[model samples]
Target: MGARRGFQEAVLAIVKKIPPGKTLSYKDVAGRAGNPHAYRAVGSILNRYDAKKWHIPCHRVVRSDLPAPRPGLYFVYAVLCGNGAIYIGQTGNLQKRWMQHRNGTASDYTRRYGARQLFHYEQHGSREEAVQREKWLKTGFGRKWLKREWKAGRTRQAGGTPGGYRWGSKRKLHLLKKEGAL
Candidate 1:
């Protein structure tokens, strides 16, 4: 237990040093933590990390095959619109793009639907990579995966309408399993 805690602490320290908007793969993190073969262990530690108790930026550690390339500023973002629609997009500057959507200057669709909240985002290392990821997220399978993975709660409206889209059905779970993301 002591050794496990020490390893977790070391991993967290390395993660904390990652600059904002940049990412390190699990393998890279493990190597930095002084155990080149402990990539999966590094991922386990990060997954179990207590964000409230520790200020480590665990989000910076991602899978090596993540769509992002190395060395640049880009992001793939997802927003839940007011009318129960999800919008996926990519940008070099996330804050600026989000503000544009909020301020009604992003696009006809977003302006008409009204962007409600930022539901998910992933940092990329270049504009090209961001665009590729954005394209993938717009696909049918990717959309389904996002819905199943990031379902959020919504308030009950008048007329007994169902709030929030529920993607926890068995079929969706099966699909996630097939994709090996579960």
Candidate 2:
């Protein structure tokens, strides 16, 4: 937490400040960390971030040249597991990935927490865009966006619970919103 002077510490601290659905290029993070020319160093520092720790959303750091994703080939998807968990993922081959999830071979998280129903999916321009979008969908902003979509009737399902991260089914979410309980 004391990264006021240490470059590595500063880089991480700055990265932790990046909001969900928002991003900063590697170079931008380096500059903010007090070293204008250490973009590579920022990447390396982020590489060391422990996945076990919180407040480090390193995936939000994008390449300097990318102006965000464009629009087509790849996909970003969300699945509603039986336990009320929403899993977000990206894939170039949507059908293949769907098969994997169905067979419980996609991820341990999905296998253990979800029955694997395709609740939402969106198109992206490339693999990079899919990856970034997957990360975004795991954030609060993405959830709210989905909620808005539900409200607009473009979608009928979503994820979130009152007391914990695990939410109920699509029907439950809809009822909660209707009764103004959510």
Candidate 3:
């Protein structure tokens, strides 16, 4: 990879280390990436991340508040749904919540969706921190901003495995075989 792409990949590698049920602000990732003050740049990189449907799990990186994105939270919601992440009652108990999801004791949203693993996570401190951040994410042009990029295909969804970029679904494959369309 080129130097810039290499740096970005290195940044994303650190991002992928964040555990489930946790969160991190853009500043957090920037600091971790050795830039310390590149929060806006980090946001820009994340927003323009093209490998979402493949190698990167950008959905887990929220604005520290874990707020659902706008245009109805479908991208985040669908991803979370697709992963079967359970809802934790307390943000402070992130580790415990993640364990529940890992162990298959997650919330209704997670169960029906068959989401089980956390591909990435970010640490956003306490419940208060998460709530405040969530509030900011919901207001302003957050939803519109996210949706435009999401619809434009920046955020790709993996059908069979988490972060895997295979283009076809097993069900689709099966149906095609049955119909002799393959």
Please list the Cα RMSD from the true structure of every candidate, rounded to 1 decimal place: 13.8, 16.1, 13.7
Task: Point out the higher-scoring one by lDDT: 1 or 3.
Answer: 1
On the 0 to 100 scale, the lDDT of residue 121 in model 3 is 32
Poorest 10 consecutive residues by lDDT, candidate 1: 156-165
| TM-score of each prediction | 0.45, 0.43, 0.33
In order, candidate lDDTs are 0.63, 0.60, 0.45
Q: Rank the candidates by TM-score, best first.
A: 1, 2, 3
Q: Candidate 2, after superposition: displacement of residue 6 in Å?
A: 71
For candidate 3, the per-residue lDDT at 138 reads 55
**lDDT per residue (tens digit) for residues 1-182 in model 3:** 57567657667887677554334456567777877667676667765666445455454443333332232121222223344332223244433354344333656655455343332232454556556554544555644544555568564332213121133345433432243222
Worst lDDT run of 10 residues, candidate 2, spans 158-167
Q: Is candidate 1 or candidate 2 better by lDDT?
A: 1
lDDT at position 181, candidate 2: 27
Greater TM-score among 1 and 3 belongs to 1
Better of 2 and 3 by lDDT: 2
